[model samples]
Every structure is written in structure tokens, then in C-alpha cells.
Target: MASEELEYAGFWIRVWASVIDTLLLGIVVYPLLTAIYGDAYWEGANFVHGPLDFLISWVLPAVAVVAFWMARQATPGKMAIAARIVDANTGNNPSTGQLLIRYLGYFVSCIPLGLGIFWVAFDSRKQGWHDKMAGTVVVRKKSGTTRPVEFNA
Candidate 1:
């Protein structure tokens, strides 16, 4: 396990990253949803209004996000801010299982009035509940410092 103090990405940066990702997903998802549901797209706030809605809203994003995390160790949003996700203890790329758990953990983070996500703002390591659940962390490179791919935790 890595054994050193590292700079963890805090809540605001992560929130902004999430916004960017959400917007990007929206660009593709909204049009597809509109086409599938037509005028009834916004008829009600139901989550699973139809099969396509379930596929488009939930399945697709989960797949895309996990794929990005596996392939790049970060999503486009995380990359934009020079942040990457890694095992919390190892400071290396998280396992596929961990990535999946992290994705599901998002729901947990959001369900309870977003307290889990907000935890990042106060945690010493800047970890949210999803990060804690998946044993992962978001970190960025220190200015003028070049370290190995695996951070020193």
C-alpha cells in the first residue's frame, strides 16, 4: 500500500467535474430521450417512464463511466481538471469491481440529500462516500511535481 500524504481533490472541483460530465451526457441523452419519448418526455418526473428511458438514462451512463474509468483511470471531466481515480490505499488504478461499485455508489451518495458527496468538503482525505465504499480516491498532480503513475497515497 502507498504510504504518504497526497493532495486529494476537494468537493468543489469534483462537483464542477460532475457538472461537465452531466452536461456532456445530457447533450447525447436529451436528444435520444426526446426521440424515444416524443412529447411525453417531460410529461412526468418518473424515473423509468419506458424501457428506452431506463436504458438511456441508467444503463448507458453506467457503462460509459465504468469504461472510461477502466481505460483511462478517469472520466473526461476528471481529466479536464487533472484528476484521476485510483485505489484509496494503493494509489493505483482501481479494480474493475471497484469501479462498478463506485458507479452504484453514486446513487447512494445522491439518495440521502447528497450528504455522501458533500462529505468530500470536510473529510481529511477529501473522500466522499462512494470513494470510501469503493476504496478509491480522486487526486491531482501537484504543480511542478512529476510523480509515478501510482501516487504515494
Candidate 2:
């Protein structure tokens, strides 16, 4: 967070990170849902098949993601990509409130055909709508070799 050669993570890398997270979540959630609802679970027209479905499919992922953000500054996927979220102005870890806002902002970003998420490709700071809403940014150091993303004390 000094004058070092830092770079905002690009769009494609972020997209890949999200894909990884979604796949991981599916790996766990899908099994639980299938076990509870049986094979016919996939045939439902309901957005949420039942209370357990809502708990497993919706609440679980949300809690997991928020917990990861709180504990690690980045989710597993972002950590895999060597990127972390920080306060846009201070380059420090964002507050819990900011993290929550960022999580909720995902819906807004996706609502308009994902134009807000796509905004990262054009934004000078490579911020998606969620980052903008929460005053955060995703960044990585210009490392010559692969390294884990970590905060400097």
C-alpha cells in the first residue's frame, strides 16, 4: 500500500475468481439440496422449493461469503488469484459495514444485465458497481512470482 507498483485486478481475472467461488459453493450446496429434495429437486419451478431449500441454497452461501470476507479480506477465489479487497481511498481493509454493503450490492450490479459488474472493465480503478457502492477496490502487487495476497502490517 505504498508507492510500490500495485495494479488493480483486471476484469477477466475477477470473472474467473467469481466462477471458481460459484463452482465451489455449488459443489457443497447441490449435494445437500439433492439429498433433501431427491432427484425431483431439479424439476421444480419454484424459486425456492421449500424452507430447507431456501436455507441451503440462499442463506448458507450468503453466510459463508460474508464470513470469508470478514476473516480473509478476500474469498477463496480471490485469494487464489492473488487479489484482495481494500478501502478505495485508504488502501486499507474495508470495514464490516462496507463489506456487507458490497455483498448486497451484487444484486444491483446483476440487475441491469450485469452492466454494473462490466463497469470494472472501463473504470479507471477496475472497480465494479459493488466496489463503488462500498468504497472498495480489488488490487494486487506486481509480483514477478506467484504469491498469496496478504495485507502489510
Give me the overall lDDT of model 1.
0.84
TM-score for candidate 2, residues paired by index: 0.90
- How do all models score by TM-score? 0.87, 0.90
Instruction: List candidate 2 segments past 4 Å from native.
Output: 1-3, 143-153
Which residue runs does candidate 1 get wrong by more than 4 Å? 1-6, 143-153
Candidate 2 lDDT by residue in tens digits, 17-133 = 999999999999989999999989998888999999999988898899888988888899998998888888777889999999999999999999999999999987788999999
lDDT of each: 0.84, 0.86
Q: What RMSD value applies to candidate 2?
A: 4.0
Give the distance in Å from residue 130's predicted Cα in candidate 2 to where it truly belongs: 0.7
**For every candidate, C-alpha RMSD to the true structure in Å:** 3.7, 4.0
Model 1 earns a TM-score of: 0.87
After the best TM-score superposition of candidate 2, give how far the Cα of residue 40 lies from its true spot, in angstroms: 0.7
